[model samples]
Target: MHSSSSSGSRLSLNSLTFSLPLKALALTVALIPFHTINASKAYQYDAVVNNNKLTVVGVENPSTVFKDGQYLHGFGYDLARNYADSMNVELVFTTVPDDATALKLVDQGKANFAITTTSIQNIESKKLTSFSATCGDLYSLQKNGLNTQLSWVFKHADDPLTQTASGFVCQGKQSGSISQLASFYNRNVVQAESWDSIERDLTKRMPIYKASFQRTAEKYDLDWHFLAAIGYQESYLKPDSISPTGVRGIMMLTNSTAKAMGVSNRTDPAQSIQGGAKYYDLMLSKFEEVPYPDRNWYALVAYNMGPGAVDQIQKRISAQGKDPNNWVNLYSYLDGNKAQNGRYRQAVQYVTRIRSYLEYIKNTPQLVNI
Candidate 1:
């Protein structure tokens, strides 16, 4: 009887051990499929309201609505972020060779959006899976004094609007025309010292000074004009302007930025503008994820007080639970004798002037292209 009891006890212990293993094995089996499903579902849509992971495809140039490095400073960036934020998802940008590639990427489902200053047309509308909305402004650059038609591609074939619009043409040769237009539209225009003299100065300035600015602008994918705007704000386009803190030249470059830009003469007009433009371009590149309208403000602040300070302001605003993109909301937090000082206020004013200038130039009968 004792032997029988011992055998039964041993059998009960074996059952307990086997039962535990069986339970564990069942749990593992259940988890394996769950992991697979999660893995297979790599891309999810509408994950959050204002944080969608969207891939924007655009060109490689600085003027493009979606520049290579400055994805957040143009109309494309603003529209994408606005849409994503409304949906609550993070935006992801994908740079493309051209508009064709952008379209192709979207059609293939490789990108969630294509925002390279696209015009809605019947052909593209049918081909692309997109929503109907004007995301940014379309600009035309024409030779000064030439009347040209501005073209628009409509979504509907029978849309009752002309494909081309007419506007006044500005004589590029007019004194202060470029500057005036720039101030009006908040966009920058290159004013050659003189068409007659540019050929002479071009050779002199090209390699040493202009090339550097061009290279930096290309590197950061920023409009040379945007940099010029910073220069205008900083030093009023005077390469010889000096600040109390010893900031010099058109860009009001300090000794440090000038040196970093490889400028040997901080007072030279060419070197000053070049260095300043490059520096502003760098600042423009930092807010690549912000929308274009808001990006300009951030760029202006960064241009005035350095990007680090602008970042601090953004953090402060965010901490206070306000939208950093909203200039109205950001202005209150940016004011006071705190971190950014009146530099923030000055930056906002400068940017506002630039924007107004851009609009004015666009509307100006003398400057508008027909």
Candidate 2:
């Protein structure tokens, strides 16, 4: 985690930075099949060419791959989903018990690739398996003399799909889509100087409204921690907090928005939290065409910029012949337009800051069950 002073902590879309914990890196001592296969040989598989389905296997890891109800979501899942989208194929995800099982399924041709938590050095030195581009945020585990990186594994060194996957990874990284995805998924949470105050609030203030956040979040099928992040961002969890713009309550809802959400009293904590969750769910439902995780991000952007503004940006994206459903595409265009577009920069920073707070909330578990 990188800490920046509150005065200087506004991260731009292109240069978001965070570090993986060394202890977390030490836990991923996984193995892959060792072989001396020639890398120059051209290889193609019938399943990949004809099936029109991208089968991916991965273990349940919060940062890599995990289940949210019926949906698979994480950094690796989104990465693989992007690759599948590029191929215009259906993504079929299978959750295995561990990295070894995921790799075995790939080797047996049951899965095209495995989202494995290992190092580039490990793959290069001993593993016959081909790997996709690094997912960024590389950390050196000096004790083991290995560089920890998250990558997808394939069965062969020269598979044609491997090259395709690498290309997609490279493009995603270059466009800042991958890092944005990482941020949205809480893969790397950057702790700023405000973190200390947030920690204090989590203990002193959050517990006071935890039940309301949890209650409304469950009602709307949303994460309470996420709702709490919005409250903290908006009004620092003070129900009576009022903005100069007249938006009030912990969620800082406008008068029109409060009325639309059926919020009678914006100063009431329960009503405010409920209204925020329902409004967020409404925003989320508007972007159902977008994939999970990205869908969540688009909804967050919508929450900050209004659904109509987001729609306009999506239209602009489509007009440019880009994938509007992909937030990275949205982010890339916004990044280029930031100098001339205040709304673009606001939406980018809004979602990024919320995700960071959400990550901080998730990491602080003691406040839960209070």
**lDDT string, candidate 1, 1-370, tens digits:** 0000101110011000001123433343344334334343323232222243545555533232323112223323333443343333455645566676666655565654454545546326545433322211113223321112212222222111111000001211122222222222222333433333433433333334444454655665555444534554566455677989998886787898889988899888767766766676576579776554445566666777788877887788789886665543454455443365567566546665544333333333432221
- lDDT value for model 1: 0.44
TM-score against native, each model: 0.40, 0.71
Question: Candidate 2: where are CA atoms >4 Å away?
Answer: 1-44, 48-53, 58-63, 66-70, 94-111, 124-126, 132-148, 171-189, 192-196, 285-293
Q: Per-residue alpha-carbon lDDT of model 2 for 289-335, expressed as tens digits?
A: 87555577777788888999889989999999877887677766666
List ranges where model 1 is wrong by over 4 Å: 1-220, 285-293, 322-329, 335-341, 360-370
Per TM-score, the best of the predicted structures is 2
Model 1 earns a TM-score of 0.40
Instruction: Give the distance in Å from residue 166's predicted Cα in candidate 1 to where it truly belongs.
Output: 34
Give the worst 10-residue stretch by lDDT in candidate 2.
1-10
Best by lDDT: 2
Question: Cα lDDT for residue 131, model 2?
Answer: 50
